[model samples]
Target: MPYQIQSYFLEIKKANLQKLRKDIWSDTPVPAILQVGDTRNNIAICYRGSYTREFRKRSYMVKFMEPNTFSDAHVIHLNAEYRDPSLFRNKLSLDFFQDLGVLSPESHHVNLIRNGSLKGVYLQLESVDEIFLKKRGLPLGPIFYAVGNGANFSLYKKGKRKKSLTSGYTKAFGNESDDKYLIELVKQVNNTPLTDFPRIIFKLIDIEKYARWLAGAVCTMNNDGFTHNYALYRNSKTGLFELIPWDYDATWGRKVSGGIMEVDYVPIGGKKTNHLSFLLLQVPEFRTLYRNILEEILETKFTVPYLTNKITSLHQTLRPHILRDPYKKKEIELFDGETEVIFQFIHDRSAYLKKRLKYLKS
Candidate 1:
């Protein structure tokens, strides 16, 4: 008989979190070197998750890291044994998004096995965008901002230790009073540093554009989107914070939902009450920038049917991966109901925004 792996695997939560990392991986291993952030998994790191490394090969460097607090390399709430035909999904997401002209990283699939069977799966991604940034005249992160937008870069220090490394938004705009003793949070603004691209807020129109892109995308293929998950970073010289998306968990499939899951309420713009309008009001130069984004997105709007068709094609391709687990087999069925609700949601949202736009114009 094939070596039967238990449903529960080397999982981690609470105190054993570090131990779980030690269980399957080691700190000394060349791949686990973390570069930034205090939280474990969310921190950017070099991960070697693909085929074993050899000197002759292109080298073992995959950017599998995400900015999550949970530190889970693999997630399972659907009671699934492992992520479904996982390798192919990454490729599907990359190709589809890139083809759609959204900035995305290139990904490769690598078959993974544990205890002599395929128990765990992951993707090997090389951020060609990062490489492109280097090859092009622009520097990776800091220097690009410093030179292009006059933004400042700071090594966030805690006492003697440099705790975090972050770049973007201006330094001169903040004060010590912004740091609160109760919440312990110094209000954060995600943008290019030094340069005031309040206009970056205008890129919110892309949400609708992306919504339209996804309206069909969600219907044809079960998809999920969360706020702040869609990132916009403007190259100061370009005067554009290109709407780049990341963390495509519920993607490239036709998921069936009996009812709206918690993931359905996924809000954009973080815990804000009213997302787009609130953001426009908070940012200083929103009206002028939004006018520009609205014109562009509407001009090149990807229709519902077109998006649905593309996503449906993608879902068909990802069938093997989507059905790898028994639970995932049922999960795809759940998506059918979910998509109808999500579709109507965006429709209402678009009309509401249209009303808002009219009010603003008046």
Candidate 2:
């Protein structure tokens, strides 16, 4: 069974409330108090995400200052889930990755109330910060958030529309000096030839782990994952980086903005020169590994029957809260329609991948 859904109440001062509302346009943290059922704590709350924060019911990042907050975790994430009406995209994606033996942030559902007003149902996720790395026994190294529209993992210099690789990362942990490793990784990807890539790529990162992460993103049709909304961390023990998926509310055959994506849409950067997918797909061995990983996921973890049950359970659990949500962005009827769309997407996507498997091998 999935974890039990939780409800939280927040009491924000009028002045702090005003600051938070303004801070949505700009990324800033405001001091506030948080109440979980009966327990109270001092926390710093901040508006998080790019386009999603602009919405009325915003997503947030919370830092619990005092110890023993939420079982030794200091930071947690609350996602507004406006784009994904089903409200289970993040949970389902994270669960799928774990089933495939990949590490991802754990997530659960929560009801948020501010100043006695119901803000709607939000997805509460474990933050991937220093505390998270410690709990996972991952080495304390540089942690980078792949942020912004220019976060496309391509070696593009700062130009009219693109931000350079150096400027694209927001370091959450470790020293700024560690960025030299990141710079070297980007150079190798952009400058190396396909034949030479295999011999040298493993020295910079773990190819097997990366292939699994890439497979997860492609199989789920998460168009944004290749570029943005990921966390890259270097392991102090191995001195290699691993990828963690983030902000998956846009997945399951939908764009980040909730637009419909075709079931047959291939997320591989087919001809794009700079993106990682473009470079990786060019290698025959890597291509075969990606295809095999996709087959494993579609066969075992991401099957239609399995995902259908997930959508059904989460819908039933979130229905009441979603309907009564005071700050819901869309009508309840539309949300109902979205649930059906999600169901059909799972079934259709499975069939589509089964057919496309032959082409991938060819």
- What's the TM-score of every candidate structure? 0.44, 0.91
Per candidate, the number of residue pairs that clash is 16, 0
The regions of model 2 sitting more than 4 angstroms off are: 157-164, 268-274
Residues 190-287 of candidate 2: C-alpha lDDT, one tens digit per residue: 67887898887767777778888877776677766766678888888897888888888887877777789888775442224226767777788877
| Regions more than 4 Å wrong, model 1 | 1-102, 107-111, 120-129, 135-139, 143-243, 248-285, 295-302, 330-332, 335-349, 359-362
User: What's the distance in Å from true for residue 242, model 2?
Assistant: 1.2
Model 1 scores a C-alpha lDDT of 0.33
Best by TM-score: 2
* Model 1, span 190-255: residue lDDT tens: 333324434433332334343333332322232333222233333434433344444343443323
